[model samples]
Target chain A: MIDPSGWDLPSLTDRWRSATPFGHVAIDDLVARAALDELRQGVSKEPHWPNRGEIFEMMASGPPQQPTPRAFLEALGGPAVRDALAAITGYRLQRVDGNSYVYLAGSYLLPHTDHRPGVDRRIAYVYYLSPEGAFTGGELDLYRCTTDGSGDIVATEIAATLAPRPNRLLLFDVGLTTLHQVREVTGGARISLAGWFY
Target chain B: MLALHRDVLSTDERAQLRATLDAAGWSAHDLADRLHLATANAGADDALFARLLDLANRTTRPLRLRAFQWLRLRRGDYQLLKHDARERPPAAHVELIVDLSAAATGEAELVYTDGGATLFYVPQLPGSVAVIERPPALLRYQRYLCLRVADAEVHRLRLTLA
Candidate 1:
């Protein structure tokens, strides 16, 4: 579990500025090992909607029945994480909302922006539960966007591929130009806590 | 396999269509030529591509095939492709769509969605073209393709949206 007491965002603005392709940053060891292990167990056991298709996403929604997952999710949305996120992304996040995701083999999310109106979500974020190399092919692929003068959009080359690692936090500004995708998982499974910061 | 539809083109029309594709840079009927121009043209000739595809994809008048494009799925890869625009500001202008499987493949499907809720799904067939009429804005849809390398044929698919 993350303790927010005496929390200070360390060089958060500097790090985001140095990140290339887009304004984003990732940090490892975001949670204690014991707490993370518990979260993985709790999340894996939660009832997730296992809807499979070409453009795929399986969600384990909250309020969670599993104690560990519920605690971890709450901690992630708590002031500590929110404050860290706000400093890093420069958005006054009102709250965070998301569910656990399990991307097993054949599961993938297609490329698109997170620009749903009235959502009030400003920063897209994810925290991986599965250990690195535990799963294959679930890269958080980010893209470069080009817009015609009239607002027509075209996603160009991929600017970065952030691998889903345990205890790592991946966050980005959410907008029409912020295109990203979770590539198809070819083996095992990818478990993560994901949501948007408002 | 999906129920193959009545061939919309006559013998002469088919010949003329082939000539048109040849004149318009689609000389070869093989997989590579078709797949390349379809994806790589970058919409520079979208109208031309759409027009030629419409001719090849013509099903029946007033309900003609809207679009025709192909996909090549290799081993251990997704055989099925999404039917609509993968990006937002959906390319909903074209509606009459058809998908054709030219090589070895697995099961395919036509699923209809209403506000993300699936209303219906129809199994698709290989070596055949799948057709979709212009769905209402209330209904969203996409095609499902499952291809396998063990099928002993290259999975070649032609997709059309009207």
Candidate 2:
């Protein structure tokens, strides 16, 4: 269990800044389980496939579906997360969202980026619902987005993979550099809640 | 043989993949061309090189496939592709408007241009709605009016052509 009070956000900010292409986040089991429970009780429905990287995300939106609540977002959007965001862009956050996703067995997501030029959001954050050691082979993979102004997209993917440890929050800037994706789930169901802060 | 080798495919499997490629309107030469683009210094006609090309091209649409594939590939990566000022027609514009509203913690109207329907998110009823816009079968896209209630904060969403 993470004592949110004990979490020293400045240190966490250091970790995030030093985090390579793989990225660093704050997650604890209690926190992860709480987030998961919120997702489970929340409705599930078809998600909008808006662009190149929204396959698993489709299940979180649309009719009779469970959308994430402010409570869950509040839990993940602690002072540390906010501070980390501030450190990255040197700007205060106007709002944070808890965009939830629940994936049954065999769900997979391809590699891509989170920040587009038109959107006014900045950071991308995630909280893993499935506990570590509960399942096998659901690893979060990060990629580097290499592009020029002319719409040429080239992604050089890093091989480092992160296990879905509950309560751990994966956070990063969805700017011109960060490109990322989740590998296919090889075993049981995987659940997570993610969002961006404006 | 319990498991197949990673790079070296059995003779039967190799032939099967080759046939599948042909069915997909691809030739060994066509596959080679794709590989050459992915690889540096296109050394055409190298035997060792051809085997590597065949192995890589066997996979379908690795970059963009169904939803799961997209999630897996973007595990640690987060990005936003682009935004535009281009004017969208009623049908296409509604989807964009809904996506933006649903993206935040607010309330708004989702207009479905094709169907001339205005959808709202009522937390009490709390359900999803699919609106058929652009009636003729010729138009491919359909609009789904989605109301996402997060944290007691409700958002009205729509999906239309961009």
Q: Interface RMSD of every candidate? A: 8.2, 11.4
B1-162, model 2: which lDDT tens digit per residue?
011122243445434433433344411110100010111121122352233333323421112111100000011221111101111232321111111111232322222222222232212111222222232311221111122222332221222321
The C-alpha stretches of model 2 lying farther than 4 A from their native spots are A1-4, A22-24, A29-58, A61-69, A75-89, A145-151, B1-162
| Candidate 1 runs further than 4 Å off | A4-10, A57-62, B1-104, B107-110, B129-131, B135-162
For all candidates in order, the CA lDDT equals 0.57, 0.41
lDDT of 2 by residue, A6-123 (tens): 5556776677767776455543443545655655555333352322122233335322234444455664456764664576446587777765565554455545566678887777
DockQ of each: 0.17, 0.03
Best by TM-score: 1
lDDT measured at residue B58 in model 2 versus the true structure, 0 to 100: 42
lDDT of 1 by residue, B36-128 (tens): 112211112355445535544454333233444333333332322222333222434333223233332444344556545665554434423
Question: How many angstroms is the interface RMSD of candidate 1?
Answer: 8.2
